[model samples]
Target: MDKIKVIITDLDGTLLNKEHQISDYSKKIFKELYDRNYLIIVATGRHHLDAMPLVAGFDFPIYLVTSNGARIHNPNKELLFSFDIESDAIKSVLDLEIDPEFTTVLFKEDVWQTNKTNEKLNKFQKELNYRPEVVNFKNETDLKAIKMFFTHESHGKLIELRDKILVNHDHLFSHAFSLPYCLEFMDKSVDKSVAISKILEIENVRFDNAVSFGDGYNDEKMLTATAHGYIMGNAPESLKKKLPQLQIIDTNEFDGVAKFLAASFLDADVLKN
Candidate 1:
């Protein structure tokens, strides 16, 4: 066989439609791409459980890099690689002055915690498909943390909280917003690029042969690191500015990722361009 070509993509606002559902066009394109022996890896800031359903019905050899690279797994649920976050580091982060009602979801063994109200968090847990244990901090036992998430509403307020945390945790951690109302935390070295490089190494594909797409600040690193990157139109201005040279494709609302792949590899008949 020749070299393996790979395309890594982010989920929301990059692969999924406005309704958070994968479109038929995308599904067909993915089928074609998988049939052609191209590797499709989903690199997202979502937890594994959340990402699993993103490609639920697709029968293809797909890989996943989740939690901003804190964990990597194959489509078959085989653990390829992972990085653990120190419990002490997590405790220090939780010590910040941020609101406790927002709660924190840790990926270490799939642990979740909150001291404030449970109404909002219970709804969140249902969306994520996990019934997190409710603890009062005094009864909590396991502290081993892999990833941390904070759910909030205001982007400006989240950024402010992020900045305050950064002051004390600078260079000690990495952060990303999986959603406008979410803040994802990982170790400093954990990011899509690091995970992509590792995947490339494992698959023996050169970095130059990889193509990636994303639409958020967490995606900026992978988009910048890859030889060719397609930024979704909905990407934040700060993220777009990070790669001033790359081309910006249509918004995820238009199936930007599937459209790009069809144009680049699939036969011309598959795309209207």
Candidate 2:
């Protein structure tokens, strides 16, 4: 295989391991890939703020495509591009009939919001290390929200909500759970494929020269769009069943993305196969 000029990767279950941390081997390989002038792009369902920790203190000036494709940020956290949601739409979203099994989170700029929070929401707060402003359904607050998240114990219910949201709001973007317990949202155009295509245009790279990795329903369009897309072996059965044609790589626990990088761009023998 010839050199892939850019490598785009999803965060939660593709680049990040079971522990939700980038392994040392992966980080080392990333450095090597960057050193060789390969542009490493963080393409994920996460927001720009959620992406910062994984990239902090890294030597290279990596680019971030977050909120699906609603936001594009450089290593320095500069907003190279962004998309917004109207305040009324955000409020209307809160008014939707939310399943008690699912907790809805409102992302107003950088802060998160919830109505009558529960333990699950509290857990996420602890994980994120930030407390969101709690409000009753009656309270009115002026906040510029860009995204919303929903978490549910039932995968089926989550799927139902995802589909219903998209059906009801043609203008809104509704994505499947990036993890087993969540659903994320932004503008309908805010997907990794669209974001990466935009980035490719800005960077003057061809779609055929780009590669990407992902393991969820949200990643389907992105994988199909890229010239070379690797689906992690640990990807959900639904994804694997849908994308049998793409190459399947090992799990992130094994530094799967990096291993592919080393073989495809670094090792000569494997390149021949």
For each candidate in the order shown, give its overall lDDT on alpha carbons.
0.78, 0.75
TM-score for each predicted model, relative to the true structure: 0.88, 0.88
lDDT of 1 by residue, 1-273 (tens): 133288889987899887777888898988888988888888987677767766775667688998889889976789888887887777777666457646556665564555554465454322565446656654555566668777766778778778888988987898887666778788898998898888888878876777889988788888877778888999887777867899999999998889988988888888863
* Global local distance difference test of model 2: 0.75
Writing each residue's lDDT as its tens digit, candidate 2 over 116-227 gives 5667545422147345777664476664466777887887888788777776676665455676667777766567788788778888887788898998877888888878
Q: What RMSD does model 1 have? A: 3.1
Q: Model 2, poorest ten-residue lDDT window? A: 121-130
Task: Quote model 2's TM-score.
Answer: 0.88
Screening candidate 2 with a backbone cut-off below 3 angstroms (N, C-alpha, C), the clashing residue pairs are: 69-190
Q: Count the backbone clashes (under 3 Å) in each candidate.
A: 0, 1
Once superposed on the true structure, which residue ranges of model 1 sit more than 4 Å away at CA? Answer: 1-4, 101-103, 114-128, 137-139
